[model samples]
Structure formats: structure tokens, C-alpha cells
Target: MKRLRRVDRTQFQKLTYPHLEFLYNMALKYCGNTYDAEDVLQETMYRAYRNFHQLRDEAKCKPWLFAILRTTFLREQRSLKKRPLLDDGSGYLKHVVDQDRKSLGALLEEKMDKANVQQLLEMMPEKHKSPLILYYMEDMTYREIADLLDIPIGTVMSRLARAKKQMKKNLLKKLGMHKKKRNFSIISVFLPGGGL
Candidate 1:
């Protein structure tokens, strides 16, 4: 077996250490607990260090690390019979509902909390949920998500569009504000003294 040299080890650490926090948080999102998350992260680092020479681009380090974490988490999940579902504490909720992202309608600034958003993510199908978690929670771009998930760019776009729609519809229903009519307006989300 080819052993990693000292310089290679240092280079690997330099490239991969900066993303430790991101990897851990994402691991938590996937595993839903500290123990499994730690296991997956440790394995990811182990695999990355062993295969550091295979990484072609330093600029793609984040996506590469993300992909490793995902695969490692999946392997860990398979070994365990049962696991709790994930919850994210990311600030994506603030950006999604209340921010200038006019593609999705505006809602009560305080209505959409992390729990509500995380619940919505939990309810989504994994294929769709993965993109949203990567994009909103991790602040990764569509391209990065596509690369990490090994899907086409168009697929990433479509999945995110559908995920957002699902989130909106579910939130509206949960908030007791679902309307059967077409052309849902941004102002429809705003309610006085009531939050999502």
C-alpha cells in the first residue's frame, strides 16, 4: 500500500481542516446525533487522508469533502438498524421565508424558525431534501450540490424548485392558511400576531 508522506499529510490537513466545522454540522444533519456524526466524520477524514493524492483540484475541496461525508454517513446508516431523523439549526429559515428571495413569497419574519424549516426538510423525499439541505443549510451553490450529489445541474435546479414548493405548501397547510386558488401571493403569508 502506498503510504502518505509527511508533506502529503500536511497538505491534506491544510486543504481539509478548514471544512471540519461544515463537515461536522452536515454530518449532524445526516445522522441526527453526535455519536453517529462523529463516527461518520472520523471515517470521512480517514478516507480523505488515505486518498489525498486522488483529489485533482484544490478549488473543489469543499465539494469533495462534502461528498465524502455523505458517502460515509450513508455507510454508517446502513450498519445501524434504526436512527432518528435529522434536524438542522441553520439560518436558512431566515433566508428562505423572510429575505429578498422573491422567487418564494415573503412570510412573517419571525414565523419561520429553524424547527419549522427542519421539519419540512424531514418530511421531504431524500432526493429532494438533499439539495435543499446543501443549498440553504450549508450555503452551497446549485453547482456544488450537483457535483457533491453526482447529479446533473438541471436535476439540481428542478429538485430545488420542487422542494421549495413543497415547503411552501406544507407550511401554508400547517399555518392554517392553505388556499385552493391559483396564483398565491407573497402578502398572503403575512399574518398579524400569528407565526408559522
Candidate 2:
């Protein structure tokens, strides 16, 4: 059996270290807590270190690292499914709505804060959320999202459409607004610069 060559420590660090913060942020989006995000980041770094030799292009490092981190997060989630339930569902932007429908209209008049936006984001399933995160939040192209998710461009488009519709429906329902088939204006207006 052919053994892999030892990686140069400095070389790996130089290439991969710059993206730790991005990876952690992405991890936070996926894991929803600092502790779990840290864990995912550590695991992602480990996997990247181990597979650094496989990287053929330096420009693709960020995307490749993101893919590793995403895979690690998914594996952790799947493993948790086999275990007992311990989550209280209280961590990571968990919001409890108690306002009546009448007051909810007032909320629609105002801008959405980060927590409310994040709460809406958390309500969606991962398969749907991933595309949104990649396309909108990360500003990646649909082709790039499809490549990262290993899905077809058409599937990415469909999932993005469905995800947007679901978010609009959820937001309108939550805020007690009329459920019009309009664009999710808040997300488009607030997401990029409003610091989601």
C-alpha cells in the first residue's frame, strides 16, 4: 500500500488559516451555537489538514473548505439522530412569539432584527436552507451552489424557489400579515448589509 506523504505544517496553515473565521461563521449557521460551531470548525480543520494534498488549486480553497465543514456538520447531525434526545431547543436564536395577530401587523411595519430573521432561517430544513445560505448570504452563484451541494442547477433553482416561498409564508404567518405571493422584501432589503 502506498503511504501518503507528510504535509508541510506551515504550508497547510498558510493556505487554510485565512478561512477559519468564514468556516466558523458558516458553522454557526449550520450548527446554531458557538460550542457546536467551534466543534465543527475543529473537525473541519482536521479534515482539511488530512486532505490538503488533494487540493489541486489554491483559488478553490474556500469552497473546498466549506464543503468539508458542511459534510462534517451533516455527519454530526446524522449521528445525533441515532442517539437519545437531549436538546431543550433553547439555544441559538430560539424565539417564542406571544404577540396577538393585531400587534403582529405593527411588526410588519418595522424592520426585522437579526434574531427574528435568524429564527425564520432556522425554521426551514437544511436541504432548503443550504441553497439560500450559499446563494444569498454567501453571494455564490447558482452554479457554485449547485456544485457545492452536488445538485443540479435546476434542482438548486427549484429548492431556492421553494425555500423562498416557505420563508415568505412563514414570515407572513408569523407577523400576521396578508399572505401575498410577493417577494420576501425584508430578507432582500435587510440581509446583505443589515447584518443577518
Candidate 3:
């Protein structure tokens, strides 16, 4: 491992250390559990520390760190040869939704609580869920999400659109089966007109 100099250490701490909580939350979402998330976080931090000097623009630290985290998680996933389990159903989306309140519209925010939104996110496929989580939860731009996920910008936008559509369908289906379906007029929340 490379030893960080005094200035390097200070720079790293200032630029990267503050994002620890963001890393943890994202790792938890990606790994879908605390233990694996911690492992991913540990590896990510270590890698970041070693590579801190290579970062050209300190302003891009978040996306750089996210790329490391995402890459490490994928490597770990491949080595383990098992898909991550969505074991925690207890309001993960709540934290994500709350993290970026400005991105959502007022009406959508009013209609959707943390739990249902979390359920909507959790139920989406990993391909779609990954981008949605980055875009909405982390409030990353489409280009940043594309860089981190290593997909094209067009693909990122397409996936997000598809994810929202899928979420609306799932939410509507779930609500329609319930007695409170009549009271819930929240399908537009996931639709394009409300917000992205």
C-alpha cells in the first residue's frame, strides 16, 4: 500500500472521509446486507487511500469513490459467485428518498412514504435498481452514474425510464389488490410528468 504523506493524508481526509456514510449506505444497498456492505466499504476505503494521489480533480471525488466502491462490489460479487440477497425489507428506500428531497416533486413526495417507495425500489431488478439508486438516492448526474456503473449515458437514461415505469406498474398492482386502492392516487408519482 502507498503511504499517504502529511498533505496527502489531509487532502484525502478532507475530500473522501466525509463521504463514509454515503459509501456505507450505498454499499448496504448494493450488497443488500450490513456484513457484506462493511466488507465492500473496507475494501473501497483501502483502495481509495492507495489511489488518492491519482485523482486529478478533487471536485470529482464522490464519483471517483463511487466507481471504486461499485467496482469492488462487483469484483466481490463475482468471486463469491452468488447474487446479493434483498434480505432487508425495512425502509431502505426511506433513507435514499430522504437523502435527496430536492430531486422529487412536492406532490410525489407527499403521496409516497418511505416504506412504499423503499418497497418499489427494492422490488425493481438490479439493472434498473442500480441506476435509480444512484440517480435518486445519491443525486448523481446521468453522466456520473454512467461512469460509475460503466455503462453509456444513453443506457443510464433508458434504464432509469424503464425502472420508473416498472415501479409504477408494480405499485399500481400492489395498491389495486388492497382495499385502500381507491384512496391512493399516487401512480403519477412514478410517471414522467411528476419528476425524474
- Which sections of candidate 2 miss by over 4 Å? 1-7, 86-196
Give the runs in model 3 whose Cα sits over 4 Å from its true position: 1-4, 82-196
Model 1, which residues run further than 4 Å from truth?
A: 1-4, 81-196
Model 1 residue 22 CA deviation in Å: 0.2
**Tens digits of lDDT, candidate 3, 1-196:** 3454877888889999889999998997686446788999999999999988789998899999999999999999796655444445873422222323344333344456777777777789999989877876677899999999999999998998898777766777767743443544445444434332
In model 2, the Cα lDDT at residue 70 comes to 91
- Highest-TM-score candidate: 2
Give one clash count per candidate, in the order shown. Answer: 0, 0, 0
Instruction: Give the C-alpha miss distance for residue 176 in model 1, angstroms.
Output: 14
Report the C-alpha lDDT of model 1 over 60-145, residue by residue, as the tens digit. 99999999889888787675535434445763322222232222211322336656666766788999888866775566787898
Q: How many backbone clashes does candidate 2 have?
A: 0
Measured against the true structure, the TM-scores of the candidates, in listed sequence, are 0.41, 0.43, 0.42
Cα lDDT computed for each candidate against the true fold: 0.70, 0.72, 0.75
Could you give the C-alpha RMSD of every candidate to the true structure, in order shown? 19.1, 18.0, 18.3
Candidate order (lDDT): 3, 2, 1
C-alpha lDDT of residue 162 in model 1: 78
Flag clash pairs in model 3: none
lDDT of 2 by residue, 74-183 (tens): 99999876665454567544223222212221232235666776788789999988887677656678899989989999999899778767776667677776465555
